[model samples]
Target: MAHRFYVVSFGSLGTPDVVWAPVTDTAFQLDFEESLWCPKALINDVLTANRLRLRVASRHGWAWADGYGRAGVSTVRDRTPEETDLPARLIEGGARDGA
Candidate 1:
């Protein structure tokens, strides 16, 4: 079996570039606090963990603990609708049409 680096992230490194070596490629994206967790030393062969749902405070809309989760698979914790900003197609336009 083989693995590929589709979306590289470096949370433990605190820098996304640290994961991408050779210092190549100009086109890229960078996010400081708003970025997602980057894998450090752990490597899942088939990928076991995935964000299933999000938790939010009942009093406010602050981001709750983004604890480990699985989409429609595991029930590690209760999920609130506000906790996930899971990207969805607002308008299902063709990719060629800049969707």
Candidate 2:
């Protein structure tokens, strides 16, 4: 059986929380309360494509969702960006001011 996937992002004032589950599952019988199901191949692709980006974001205290075959709650630190190699233009104006 093919596994479905979900990408849940915790809510914030600016961005609402979201659960990216399979829409085609009309029965909604998937057990996702404790864990999401992301396929192994896709997870590998994502990790390979975003390895550098993920590493840099980690340095800025950003958090990520659990990967394929993993189960856990996501977390992030609330703090101002002290420094970053990422361009300032990429960040929003408010974030630039330590918002």
Candidate 3:
């Protein structure tokens, strides 16, 4: 049987918290709960206290779903010219560089 893949981003992209697990809900929930280390605490509590954020995505159809897979692919496009130039424009507008 084909399996679906789930990408869980706990903090930010490329961070160690970003993980891909198989079998949909079960795997993700198990891993997430383990990380929290608080079986009694609600998931919402962990999110609020740690500022934890999650982004989940899946590929259409199915390929394989087994244990945690690290070979998953995620691509990020480069910033547009306008986006890249925002910092310069802000600096010109009297905004401090690091502020």
Candidate 4:
């Protein structure tokens, strides 16, 4: 069976900010201290929506490690509830009304 995995980069708030790459090799060794594993499916939704290019960059970011022997999926939050509420706040403040 072919297994798939994702390497993700997270922001300071522990939200996944970027997807580094995907590997099918379950035995692939990662720089364990610096990175973590996530399931390919979990990241696929975001990857498809944003059309993000998957590639590893710098060394500091959060990662999701599913408990399964194979990589697992986790809930990915692109922004905090407060962050997502900004537009609503702006609209309520009349910013959208050209105030």
Candidate 5:
């Protein structure tokens, strides 16, 4: 198969209830893409809002979530622009301010 990477979306990315999938790979992983999300629509609005800020509530005591998954393809990695190089750059890591 092809290369793959996991996505943790905020706003409306894979926000449960399976609304929209602008960037279609599969129902396995999600992206940090604003275009691929709704930003204000979610199964539970509060959970959606919280996730948008990356506000995770871990069992370690900081983040929480209803569910999470891996994009079903092959593997998962960073596909960010500056963080990656290529014709392969199409799936480069998300743009980071540090770059």
Candidate 6:
């Protein structure tokens, strides 16, 4: 199957930003920390290994580890309703209308 360059942007888990390049783009590199580009095949390897759920965030897309994760997904108890509520001070304190 054909692969293309991918923007490996920041995930919430602190994965490094990179440009996953095709062999045609440059010689293959295994050292990720020293460079911003790596062979695109590396991405396929990682995604397969991690078994993450991937999805497009919007038309201009990004990936997350798991689409179904919500607050407290890993915890035994859900967060308190008060903990989840948006602070009234934030809303009242010079916040923009649409924001």
Best by TM-score: 4
Give me candidate 6's TM-score against the actual structure: 0.18
Q: Give the clashing residue pairs of candidate 6, or none.
A: none
The lDDT per prediction is: 0.22, 0.26, 0.30, 0.28, 0.28, 0.24
Q: Show model 5 residue runs off by greater than 4 Å.
A: 9-25, 28-35, 41-99
- The residue ranges of model 2 lying beyond 4 angstroms of the native Cα positions read 1-15, 18-38, 42-53, 56-60, 65-99
Give residue 8's error in model 1 in angstroms.
20
Alpha-carbon error at 27 in model 6, in Å?
16
Candidate 1 structure quality by residue, lDDT tens digits, 1-99: 221111223332222233222211121122112123322212443433223223222221122122222111111133222222311110121121111
- In model 5, state the lDDT of residue 36: 31
lDDT of 6 by residue, 7-99 (tens): 222233222332232232122222221132222435665322222233222222222222122111111123221222221221223222222
Candidate 3 stretches greater than 4 Å from native: 1-3, 7-21, 34-48, 55-99
Error of 3 at 55 (Å): 4.5
- In candidate 5 the C-alpha lDDT for residue 85 amounts to 33
- The candidate scoring highest on lDDT is 3
lDDT of 5: 0.28
Candidate 5: tens digits of C-alpha lDDT, residues 71-95: 1112324232123232122123222
Off by over 4 Å in 1: 1-42, 50-54, 67-99
- As a whole number from 0 to 100, the lDDT of residue 61 in candidate 3 is 26
RMSD of 4: 16.2
Residue 58 in candidate 1, Cα distance off native in Å: 2.4
Q: Write the per-residue lDDT of candidate 2 for residues 5-91, one digit (tens) a residue.
A: 222333321233333332323222232232232344345653222121111133332322222222111213422222321212222
lDDT of 5 at 67: 21
Candidate 6 wrong stretches, greater than 4 Å: 1-17, 22-51, 62-99
Could you give me the TM-score of model 4 versus the true structure? 0.24
